[model samples]
Target chain A: MPLIKEGVLAEDNWQSLADEDNLVDGPIVVSLERWQEERESLLARNTPLGLRLRSDQSPALVVDDLERFSVVALEFPKFADGRAYSYARLLRDRYGFKGEVRAVGHVFRDQFLLMQRCGFDAFEVADPAAVEAWEQAVSEISVTYQPGADARRPALALRRSRPAVA
Target chain B: MYRYDEFDHTLVSERVHQFRDQVERRLAGELTEDQFKPLRLMNGLYLQLHAYMLRVAVPYGTLSSTQMRKLAFVARRYDKGYGHFTTRQNIQFNWPKLEETPDILAELAEVEMHAIQTSGNCIRNTTSDQFAGAAADEIEDPRVYCEIIRQWSTLHPEFTFLPRKFKIAVTGADHDRAAVRVHDIGLQMCRNEAGEVGFEVIVGGGLGRTPVIGQTIREFLPKQHLLSYLEAILRVYNQLGRRDNLYKARIKILVRSEGIESFSRMVEEEWSHIKDSALQLPLDEIARIENYFAAPRYEHLDDNVREFEVKRFEDREFASWVRTNVTAHKQPGYAVATISLKPVGKPPGDASAWQMDAVADLAESYSFSEIRVTHEQNLVLAHVKKADLYALWLGLRDLELATPNAGLLSDMIACPGLDYCNLANARSIPVAQRISERFSDLERQHDIGALKIKISGCINACGHHHVGHIGLLGVDKKGEEFYQITLGGSADENTAIGKIVGPAFSYDDVVGAVEDIVDTYLEYRTDGEEFNDTYRRVGLAPFKEKLYAAH
Candidate 1:
């Protein structure tokens, strides 16, 4: 899998460990269940930590533990399932998590712009040559209506600040 | 009608470019059908049984003459010279090649229109009363808030991929012409005891396989908190709505499974976090949107026109039309005229391109260049002079648009069923045509007054059969088509779901079943009782007995 960060292919330094796999010394990603089960051991050996949550899991469950992880990977499970989109916003706007939010599993280039607006910074893609497509997707739509996690000013705020043209 | 600003223009143009790119990618085999389905659906393009069907949103059911003419152009150039006005205050073109859809969208954008959110799992086009600004009974124009919502939900990043499609409706008048109670989020404008106007928010009402009437989650929500409050509700639904089963994914199912009290509590808890967020509407912004819907300048004239009364007395046909099609307006000399698309034996809501152009011209000449598409699948000239109605009727009669059956039995609502839709089990438009042909006599239709017969081809209930006075749902039993009848449903302020009367009827026998039901109603009705009132008073026993006892 190709990892895209900030619209470019980036190296993956973090290893996603399975349930029975031993945690290495470098930064590693663990499932929510594993994090909940071996919290003490993981905290004791923490070089860097990341948490992965399934689409069915709500971000509210790990709100108190958001400070312990440097990355939070929200799983899409499928492109049609949109629960993780809300979970990403909750992780950013509600819990004030200041870390990387990665999109994993069934993430496509077409949904990159929306995922970015909803506070996703890293995406796992099936092909590395999709970098140009991802760049074009993020910049295709320059205007949006509502406020999101992105820094772009919403149309409402722009209308409010500007004087009436007529 | 609200004109587009620079921001609105830019947003739509960008969206068109994005959709054009998506289409190119799909055609080039870069995107698969599964990946492209949501993209096309969000742009209001659906692959039906035949070619592509494109639904163009008429925001809040309002259109200018220029916009109507543009619609006529699209129908002529891209479709088969006709368009189907739908129950959602939108228009659908049945046959458009996949390659030409982007061009159609670009043309629509030239008229400040796009098909955004007309379909898909996101929020749909917001519907309001067709008689929004001109009705005498309206407390305020619901289009102001509808436009605000249109902008807010245009490309909402968080809610673009919901569990299922969402619908919202608003009505400012005491009477619910928009059928607010059956939508996913219904906003009824009302004044609290303190004399401040707000909304009575109704949540999770829908009409599909599992029909449910929405309950009031909030008795009074202040006007300024509309978007933030809606955001809270959507967030809750998006996070908690069922996603496992496609059949049970609507917000209505979630509300039903978690009880109204629990759902309301959860919504309130979610709302507490974002009540004062940037989603809150500033008063100036509200006023800015409201200015676009301000009342048009009117000439000071007498309320009663002697010439109109004289014309009415001289021509009985004109008198009947005025009684059924004309409604009172707040402006004294003005009136609202409904142009019935339902002729004697045609598809319920389909209009030809020439008819669209002629109606545009008529609207420009007499109706202050404004038109409205009703949720009941009809068109309205919302602002017309009372004295000019005779001339307007003459023009409409020539074009076969002057049926004078606005609320009568022949004016039915039917979906484009098995003929064009991929999901239908039986044909709906032909049944509507048969029913219309059976009740073609003008005097007889007037006698059987104010009945709404809605027919759906399948249980998805796009025709709103759940709320029709006499509802018909098409079913597939064995290898044949069958129709099931329901009685006494309504979509007005006192909304009620209809009940099934008896067994399903075959295509050949369905018209006879309908006639028997109507005959039973006529036999038992009082002097001035409508079909719905008669059915309510007598219940379904007499009608069922009349149909089944003879068999």
Candidate 2:
């Protein structure tokens, strides 16, 4: 699967370590359980480390490990679940985690902008082939009213760009 | 009414195209009804029993003459020659074909309107006091903040997919015309010790199956911090509100279970981080929006209009109408006139194409080109010159819009009920019509004075039956429609969920039961107190005994 980093297609660097998979030399992403068990040795690894958080898990749990990990991948268990959106914001704004916040599963073109607004710098979508089209969703609305972690100007700044039609 | 800026125009215009594409894909069989249901609801299109019902948001019940004319055009073109104004201050067209909705929305967008977020699990349209700006007693205009909330809640990335639907109502005056207590998040504008305008924020009040009066979570939230505070409350609910049981998923239920103390703490903790963030409303921007809602210029005239006094003295019928329908306006020579949608035998809150066009013309000519739809299912001309009240009444009489009942027995709020709603278990419209017809005599209705008869077809309480002074909730038991009556409920400052009096009445006896309850009030009254006041003073024992005697 292809990953989106900073609005462009990128090869997925961090691989999730499954039950039977062995670790390689490159950076690795592991489940919350795996990270909890191997926190000492995983931090000791030369490669960059990351954690994959499930929908039920809070980003507050990773507060102490903010500097320990380079990425925090939040999982969307299903389409209706929005807990991950909050987690991404919490990680980016609350904990001051200046790391890659990736949206892992069940990502779609429709919610691409929503994910981006919630501070997901990286996206490992269900279908990577649709990345180019998903990139266009960010510009669907030229202006936004809410403040988010995404690098878009607030509506006030953009108000002058499009004058009122008197 | 607020004019749409270029940004707003572009936003709504682009949304029409998005909906058009979505509808085209659904028609092309690329998307199933299951996949398109939520998407369609986000745009306020509901699949009703007879056809597609399109609910268009009348934000805070304010509409310009242009928008009103456009609505009339839409009603004539797409619907069955009429539109139903709803309790949430929206208008629902009962017979728009699914294929024509995109075109309908496109037409609506031309007049700075759309059906966006009118229905769905998202933060629905922010409602406020219908007489927000013109009300004599208002501290500040609530629409300014309501518009702010509308912009922020539109396509809100995080709060869109909440556990259940959320509603927010605001009142700018001391009197609670907006029914702020029965909303998910109710903001009552107030002044602090230092004379700063702010909101007395309440959380978790709702009417459906588990009706609960909202509790105040914050005594005073500063005006500038409105968005940040709302964001905090929503964030807390999104994380903790129940998703397992749809029945118990509303913010009211969450507030009830979590307790107000704990909920307040959580919201405060969240607000601590985002208080002065980008969501903090800039003072200039707030003023910019406020400038749109400034009071219109008024002519210098005496408080007592000699013509109105003379007309009141000479014409008994006109005097009766004026006594009930006319309310004081802030300006000395002006009055706020309510045009009741409920007539003797018509469906409540419904307006025909002719009626809509006439209203637009009337508003343009007499009321600063602004009309308001009241939660009580009536239209208000907010700034009419008292001297012209007679002419306005004559004009309204021609359109059959002059139903002199603002808070009388026949002035009822009822849902479309089984006539259109797929979720309704009984017919509310026919029941309302029957009650209105039962007590159709104008003199008798006036003598009875100020009774709220709200009937909901089902437990969803779309009719606001829970807060009606004479509340009636229609139920279906073994396929027979039965009505449950509750006494002493109000949406005013003293907000309380009505208590079910006794066993339900059969549809045949429902009107008679209501009559019996009203008779009970008349018999026990010392003075001519309103039905709600009488009920509260005397208690439900007498009313209950009369209602359930034959049951």
Candidate 3:
């Protein structure tokens, strides 16, 4: 899998640990269940902790512990299961967690832009060959209608600020 | 009547290019059908039973003559020389090659139209009253808010992929011509005691397998907070709506299972958070959108046109057409006229390219180049001068578009059942054609008066069978077609789901069953009572006994 960040393939530094795996020292990601069950131990040895949430898990469950993690990865489960998109927005806009929100599981090139708008900064792609298509996908739609967590101003605001037509 | 500004133009143009790329990928096998299905559906392209069915959204059912002509062009060039005006007030081309869809969308964009959000699990096209701006009894024009919802819901990042497809409808007038009560979210424009116009927000009224009339979540939602409130509802549904079972995914099931009070509380809580956010509509922005729907210029004239009156008195046929098709307009000299697509022994809602071009010509010549597609599968010229009514009727009669059966039994809403839809278990159009032929007599149809016969092939209820005055659901019993009947469903301000009458009627006997039901209504009805009112007063026993007497 290739990690796309800031419109280009980036090296993934965080190690995602399985439920049975031993904890490592450097930046590591664990499942939400693991974070909940081993909260005290993980926090004591917190070497740049990251939390992974499934499609059904809400970011609100970990709202109080958001500042403790440097990264929060949201799973798509499937591309059509879009609960993660709302989760990303909640993490960024509602909880105001200034951290890397990564999209994992079934993330494709076409969904890169939408995920970005919903505040995902990184995506794990199934095909490394399609990394070049990521940039094109994100920039294909230069105009949008709704205001998102992304910095791009919505068309309504742009229309209001633009000089009135004669 | 809202024209696309620069932002809209850019967005639509870019979307065309994007879809073109996706189609190219699909053809080249870079993307499988599984991955490309949602992308194509979101762009309003569907791989139906026969070929690609491209549904083009007519925003709030409004179309300029240029757009209608372009639709005609697409029908001739790409499709099978015809289009089907859908129950959602959009148009569907039933036979476009998948390869040619990008070209079709590009051409549609030239006329400031694209098929975005017309399909898929995203927020579908926001439908509204066909007579929005021109209606005499309107509180305020619903098109402004519909356009506003269109912008906010188009390519909405957070809410696109939900458990099921979402539909929203708005009705401005006291009469619910848009069928607002049967949508996922229904907005009825109303005024408070202080004379402030707002919305009565209704949530989770849908007509599919589990039909439920929506409950009022808010009695009065201030006009400015419409988008925010909608966002709140969508958020709650997206986060909590059932995704485990496909049949239970609709918001109606959620509202039903959780009860409306609890659902309303959740929506209110969510709304309180985002009601003051950027989603809150600004006054200037509302004014800007409202300006687009501002009334067309009209010359002052007396309401009574001497020529129209004389022609109506002399020509009985013309008088009958006017009495059925013409509706009152707010402007004194103007009227709203419906061009019936349901002719004798023809499929309802099927308009040939030639008819589309003819309609465009009539609209351009008489109605300020504007047209409307109604949810009843009819076309409306919403702003015709009363004096020009005779000429319009002549033009329509030549094209066979003037059926003089508006709101009559023959003007049915039938889905393209097993004929073109994979989901359909039985055929709908042939049954509708048979029923229409049975009641083809104009005088008898006028005598029946204001009966809606909606038919659906399956339980999905695309034909709005649950809301029809005489609802018919085509079912498959032992691999043969049989029709089940329901009586007294109405989709107006007083919306109610019809009750099932009795056992199903065989294909050979279904039209006769409908006739029997109508005959029963006539037999029992008092003077001035419509079919719905008659059924409401007398109950369904008479219709059921009459329909199932042989059995």
- i-RMS for every candidate (Å) is 0.8, 1.3, 0.8
Off by over 4 Å in 1: A164-166
Show where candidate 3 strays beyond 4 Å. none
DockQ of each: 0.84, 0.58, 0.82
Q: Chain A TM-score for each candidate, in the given order?
A: 0.96, 0.88, 0.96
Best of the two (1, 2) by DockQ: 1
| lDDT (tens digit, per residue) of candidate 1 on A93-163 | 88999999999998888889889999999999886667769878898888888889889899889887887
User: How far in Å is the alpha carbon of B79 misplaced in model 3?
Assistant: 1.2
- The candidates, ranked best first by lDDT, are 1, 3, 2
lDDT of 1 by residue, B281-370 (tens): 999989999999998877887989999999999999999999899999999888999999899889999899999999999999999899
Model 1 interface Cα RMSD in Å: 0.8
Which residue pairs collide in model 2, if any? none
- TM-scores for all candidates? 0.99, 0.96, 0.99
Quote the lDDT for B550 in model 2: 52
